[model samples]
Target: MSNIIEIKNITKEFKVLNRREGLKGSLKDLFSRDYKIVRAVDNISMNITQGEIVGYLGPNGAGKSTTIKMMTGILEPTSGEILVDGCIPYKNRTRNAQNIGVVFGQRTQLWWALPLVESFKILKDIYGVTDKDYKDMLELYQSLVDIEPLLHKPVRQMSLGQRTLSDILAAFLHNPKIVFLDEPTIGLDVSMKAKIRTLIHALNKEKNTTVILTTHDMGDVDALCRRIVIIDKGKMLYDNDIEHLKGFFGYYRTLKIRVSGSLSETAEKIAAEFPEFSVSANDEWISVLVDEAKSTVMDVLSQLQKTYKIRDMQLEEISTEEVIKKIYEEGVK
Candidate 1:
């Protein structure tokens, strides 16, 4: 597959004003000139292939937003290059806008007072979409998002979930080959979130849309993306297949145990004997974090049963979110 987006050594910086103290600080910030350069996006590079859905994840203020802004032509990079659909996003703003779609979860891009259909009409005019193409897109989006019930409803009267779904439809009305979604499912109910995820999957499969999704929702990443690129502290930490990343942290396992009696010191001793395991207890229940490669859950359970009566036991694979959290807490040093 051809690359749809190529970002090469891109970096962005912001000038932050320095303030002194109290009332003087406010006055000094206005007149006294002192500034510090904050590097929002450190040098980063990656290629997004056409028709691929990529999950772009990072902690807050980690340059995920800055990088997306640079890619969408909302902000210019201080250094390096960003190419979307073979065009420089910042240099060719008009062309880039026509070729790409963007949805921001925190804000609405549709006309507030207009009916949903009217908003679509306005977008059709803005993008100069042909009559036949507009009709086809409208039909497809209606089926995908089921917006017929909301078509005549004014934007101001619609719920946040409704408005968000409408915004997503508007972004893709032009049938842009590349779409950028920033927290698209944030703050939505489970059913609505599932609807949006289904829509995204359908669009990628049917239209061959290349999607770049930035979200804090692990569910979104798990459901929609095959590949993930994670960044932290303005640096890329991991960029590879999601399964591969999960396997790297696969050694960590969780063992949930239900005990007939209180967890004893002997149980603690056995857990302590395993150098790679960590144990935590609450009331009649005990949870153990074990290194599956070094000691299996069965080993822990077998020792516990030999010493005490076992009520119930279950083992679970470590979640992706927990693995990522560990990575963030302890950098790849």
Candidate 2:
């Protein structure tokens, strides 16, 4: 497959004024030469193949937003190169806008007072979609989502999930080659998240639209992304499929145990016993994050049994959420 988005050694820096407190200081700060250059995105490179749904994972302040803005023509990179469908996003802003769509959470492109259908018509005209193409787009949406009931509802009147769905629909109304969705399911319930995930998957398969999703919701990553890119401290850390990423810490495991004693005391004892592993306790269970390189699961279990009786225990592989957490705290070696 051809690469739809190519970013090479891209870097973005912002000049922020160090404003001093109080009006006297604030006035002088306006003319103050003191400024700090914050490198929001370091030298990072990735090529996204056409029709791929990539989860751009990162903690806040990790440059995910800056990277996306550069890709969408909203912000220019300070250094390096980016090409979205063969056009430099910052240099050819107008042309770039035509080839891509974006939906930021809580930011509706649809008119607040206008019906959803009216919004679709407005977007169709804005994108210069032909009559046949507009009709075809609606057909595609219908096949994937039940958009009829939402057609007459005004954007302001829709619920959170409904409005989010509408925003995504509006973004895809013109059938752009690529779509960027930021926190699309941030605050949605499980049912709506599932619905939106299904809608996005169906649309991607049917329309072959390349998707770039940035979200903290693990469920979104698990459902929509075959590939994921992880970044931290303004630098790219890991880029691969979920299964492949898991291999980085394959020896990692989570052991949950129920003991016939105080959870906190049990937790403290376990922590002291294996200072290398992470140990925590809730109301009913004492959970430990074990790195087998430091100690095997059986070795940790036997040591735990020496102190307190193990009532119930379950050992499981590290989860996607835990993997992400680990990567954020300590980047993959």
Candidate 3:
């Protein structure tokens, strides 16, 4: 498949005034050019192909949203190029909108008082979706999800999950070539989250819509994305398949143990003993992410048994969230 979205050396900068502490400073700031330029997105470049679901991940203020805004034509980049389906998003926003769909978190595209179907109808007209295509989309939704009952309900009366579901349906009603979903499953129950993930996957498969999903939830990334792009502090970090990214920390495993003493002190002691491993403590457990390649679990256990008493311990495979956390804290090692 051809690339549906192309972003090259994209940079977004914002100038924020350096405010003074008092009213005098605030007054000076209004007329003064003494401000700082914050780079929200820095020299990031990536291409997304058609029919692919990519997880764009980062913590808050990590420039994930800024990049999405540039792609969706809501904000123009300070430098570099962004082409969505062959059109410059900021330059040809109208044409770009026609070929792409968007669903931001908790922001309903549907009319607040309108029924789900009514919103769909308005979108159909706005996007110029044909009667045949519209019917086909509804049929696809029925096969993929049992949302027929909620179609007639007003968006205002719908639960958070139901409204989000309806919004997704409306986005795909036009059968756009690309869809940008920012935190699609935010604030949803586990079952609802699963449904939304399945819906997005099915839609991408059935309609071949390229999807760019920005989410903090690892479950959403694991379930819906084959590839992921991670950025932090406006800098591109990792862009690869989930398996390949996990390979970076393949030798690592979590060792969770119940310690009798103060968790912080125990954790500090453990860290001092094993300077090589990443050790952290919580109220319940002192979790140590051990790189088994350097030292075996039994070796570490034997060494630890001499000083601190380990009441209960469990070994777990390193999770996606853990690996990403490590990356964020220490960068790619």
Model 2 earns a TM-score of 0.95
Model 1, 76-192: lDDT tens per residue? 999999989898888999999999999988688999999999998999999999999999988888778667899999989998888888888888889998999999999999999
The lDDT ranking, best first, is 2, 3, 1
Best by lDDT: 2
Top candidate on TM-score is 2
When summed lDDT is taken over every stretch of 10 residues in candidate 1, the lowest stretch is 261-270
Question: Which residue pairs in candidate 3 have backbone atoms (N, alpha carbon, C) closer than 3 angstroms, thus clashing?
Answer: none
What TM-scores do the predictions have? 0.92, 0.95, 0.93
Error of 2 at 50 (Å): 0.4
Clashing pairs in 1: none
Runs of candidate 2 with Cα error greater than 4 angstroms are none
Answer with 1 or 3, whichever has the higher lDDT.
3
> Candidate 3: TM-score?
0.93
- Candidate 2: deviation at residue 317, Å? 2.3
What is each predicted model's overall lDDT from 0 to 1? 0.86, 0.91, 0.90
Q: For residues 1-333, could you state the per-residue lDDT of candidate 3 as single tens digits?
A: 688899999999999888888888788878998889999999999999999999999889999989998998989999999999888999988998898889977999889998888888888899888999888888888888887788889999999999899889888889999999989999999999999999999899988899999998999999999999999999999999998887786578788888788889889999999999889888679888888889888888888888988899998888889888888888876
Query: RMSDs, each prediction?
Result: 2.3, 1.6, 2.0
